[model samples]
Target: MADAREPVVVIGLGRFGTALALELAERGHEVLAVDRSDARVQALSGQLTQVVAADSTDIDALRQLGVQDFYRAVVAIGSELEPSILTTSLLVELEIEDIWAKAVSDHHGRILRRIGAHHVVFPEHEMGERVAHLLSGQLLDYMPIDTDFALAKIRPPHSAVGVPLAESRLRSRHGVTAVAVKREDGSFTYAGQDTVLSHDDTILIVGREADIERLVTRS
Candidate 1:
């Protein structure tokens, strides 16, 4: 659990916002949850540090709740573009340290960014991408290390089996570096020229997206 000093304000009382607030509270952050519905506020009152029934789009109401100085504020209003935009704009005007807003589409994300949201999250799209990757056999896992680089776990090709790292020329041909390898016997091997690929071995590779895809599809 995290320390309680970190403070967060969550706008909206929908499932997504409520879940985020609850998770932050569980991690020991002081969370202030706000919504326009009294029933929604009542439902989550005991689970958070503060739960208020007020329109987040109202700047005066937000100021009254001390939201101007929050460590971070999240706009989790789903499907409602008007409230989401208003809330994001209010957070920026308040000069909160960080602002995270959820967008249902790429167009919405662009609008949120234009309004000074520090981060725009597409939860539904990202979740779909992860599920699609999991269903694809070649990729065991995929994680973006940076804008242009990725770290991936992949099964070795049949031709790579029994070949030493130096002779495979994976780095030269595929532009990827094997960081670690899990052998068939369950022993792990860090990157070394002497290491030989074994059948059923899972290798961790770091490289650009296209190169990683080429390595995964290589025969």
Candidate 2:
């Protein structure tokens, strides 16, 4: 976990980078926003702690901006593979400790990891899959975990509502694990073996995609 008190540096001021920097600033974390373009740095100057116009791939520039002092850094260069990889490499060499990079493809992700990025994300692919799951109408919301499992928000089955979890046979029948239960009034309770389901309850489940599909289809 990132320490909120430490200043965070965000390299690149594209949509993802700008959004992340603004959100971190709003959460009370000091943020240093950097971009190669004047427009991007200027657009976010008033909202973040500070904004700098510089090329992140230049080691001297990073040092000049004191980027190495921050433990948390996000390389948000999208599509530009060369700059993104170079920035990640520079951060790693500086031993910044926590490096997160956005990658457009598996190869890009692999390169980032090989160069020591702490975390790599594919925002477009992830969002596309999440939207697909919601479009299926069976899932209220969904997030992918690895390639096999997911955390899914779904409506409790009509047959299972008003019944205790022990009697639901969800685990035995559908091979899914329930994580939490959300009530209509917005209160939440950890799902347990004896918890009773309500008509307005939502359940968060983790399971295999095939099994999750079967569970929802059966419900």
Candidate 3:
């Protein structure tokens, strides 16, 4: 198993890369931020374990900076296709166990995976989708667990209000499971079959993405 304390190397220093590196550092992970721009490196200096101005695509420079020693790497070079692919390939060649790459599109994502990136993220695209879902105003929050499944936070539907979950038949009716509920007290509690739901209560539901969407958009 990979140690959580293991140092991670992040390349690019762009908006996505900088945010990821800082978040990782905030979570107590040792991070090395690398970018070719001296200004970017200088801006992040003293904020991370290490920040260096170096071309990530250059294998010699990467080796000199001891990047091969890190077990994980995230290639976050957005808008630059060649550097992103080259950097990811070099990390794979360096035998990094975990490689996460940011892709601007499906083709770019395929290339990253083909070059041995263990994980690929589309931050811009995903955020757009999440924002579109939130625009409906039916859900307070939405998290996709996988391609087909999701968890959503929403107010109890009219049929579900003033009834216990067991009698509400929410699962049978809407094909969604209410896992937890947050009441007027601003505290969350586990919701069982006998838990009664009120109009003001917020419910955390889990189910197939289609089912959750149907439940929220239902009349």
lDDT of 3 by residue, 76-116 (tens): 89899999999999999999999999999999999999989
Write down the TM-score of every candidate: 0.80, 0.93, 0.95
Query: Which candidate ranks first by lDDT, i.e. highest?
Result: 3
Stretches of candidate 1 exceeding 4 Å from the true structure: 1-5, 144-149, 159-167, 180-197
For model 2, name the residue pairs that clash: none
Q: Which stretches of candidate 3 lie over 4 Å from their true place?
A: none
What is each predicted model's overall lDDT from 0 to 1? 0.85, 0.90, 0.91
Candidate 2 C-alpha lDDT tens digits along 68-114: 88889999997899999999999999999999999999999999999
Scanning candidate 3 in windows of ten residues, the lowest lDDT window is 125-134
lDDT for model 2, please: 0.90
In model 2, the runs with Cα more than 4 Å from the true position are: 1-4
Candidate 1, residue 183: CA error in Å?
5.3
**lDDT, model 1, position 120:** 89
TM-score of 3: 0.95
Q: Write the per-residue lDDT of candidate 1 for residues 45-153, one digit (tens) a residue.
A: 7788699999888999999999987878899996899999989998999988788999999899999999999898887876676567667778989876665688888
- The 10 consecutive residues of candidate 1 with the worst lDDT sum are 1-10
